[model samples]
Target chain A: SQTIHQWPATLVQPVGSPLSLECTVEGTSNPNLYWYRQAAGRGLQLLFYSVGIGQISSEVPQNLSASRPQDRQFILSSKKLLLSDSGFYLCASTGGHTEAFFGQGTRLTVV
Target chain B: GESVGLHLPTLSVQEGDNSIINCAYSNSASDYFIWYKQESGKGPQFIIDIRSNMDKRQGQRVTVLLNKTVKHLSLQIAATQPGDSAVYFCAADNQAGTALIFGKGTTLSVSS
Candidate 1:
């Protein structure tokens, strides 16, 4: 079975602080990875996706960035946090078109 | 200009009743559609999915219906329970190999 894991399930950061969120997948390799954010009562907003190591496609222009250091390890980072950056961040992996497995999201609160 | 949207923002149903949620997409190239359920403080969980070639697909107590002509999709939940209360989202896969485009969610509230 495939499983995804994300760290720092919840975080509160001050304005202008650096951010780092890590996602790792177990039981699968060479899978596509994605980073998404969901605002309250809104749809999910795709932030970044990685097909292979060192390759990342950002879906939106913002203070956030993503990197795939390994085949199953993805990282979402930011140099400075903005108040608008606060939301629930999710990490997902897809094996095929059936469905995507998601990790328990991280609730980020920027003050 | 491709976007996905839900017909209703929220739906309330009594426990043990069946629930239907609707969604619409504008992209004609979409080949796959999926429904997800996200509970409070949790990530979205896969409920069911239907391919373009097929109009209906079923899972454990959940079903997905796709209407390619109208570019619409729906999720049906039978015998809804309190645990089934969550935000439901539908995503359309353009087969672009990028990612699924998600629609604004519809909150399902199940009351006993």
Candidate 2:
């Protein structure tokens, strides 16, 4: 079975502070990884996605960036956080056309 | 750029009733679609998926219907419960191994 893990399930960051969220997948290799942000009462916005290590595609431009250091390890980072950055961030992995499994998610509160 | 969007922003239904949510996609090349449920303070969970080759697929109390002709999709939940109250999103994939384009979510509120 495949399992996805995310850390700092909940985060509170002051404005202009740095941000880092981690996501790791087990039981799969070379899977597609994605970062999505969903605001209250809004649809998810794809921030970035990686098909392989050291390769990433940005969907929406923002202060956030993504990196896939390993085959199954993905990280979302920001040099400075903004109040608008507050939202629910999700990490997803897909082995194929099969359903994409999501992590528990990181609730970022930028105050 | 092409995108996926929902027909409604919110839906309210009575417990034990069936619920249906609709989505529209602009990408004609999309060959795969998925439905997801996101509860409060949680990540989106996979509910069901349908391929472009098929028009419908069922899982437990949920059914996903795909209309490639209209580029529309729908999800039907049978005997809805309060626990089914969540934000539902539809995602589309045009190319294999590509990032899915997600639709704006519809908040389903089921009242007992």
* DockQ leader: 2
CAPRI quality level assigned to candidate 2 from its DockQ score: medium
RMSD of 2: 1.3
Model 1 residue runs over 4 Å out of place are none
TM-score of 2: 0.95
Q: Compared with the true structure, what per-residue lDDT tens digits does model 2 show for residues B10-77?
A: 99999999999999999888888999998888888889998888999999999999998999999999
Steric clash pairs (candidate 2): none
Q: Which lDDT tens digits does candidate 1 get at residues A1-50?
A: 67999988999999999999999999999988999999887899889988
The interface root mean square deviation of candidate 1 comes to 1.2
True contacts kept of each: 0.67, 0.76
Which ranges in model 2 have alpha carbons more than 4 Å from their true place?
B94-97
User: In terms of TM-score, which candidate is strongest?
Assistant: 1
The TM-scores, chain A only, for the candidates as listed are: 0.97, 0.97
Query: Where is the poorest 10-residue window by lDDT in model 1 chain B?
Result: B92-101
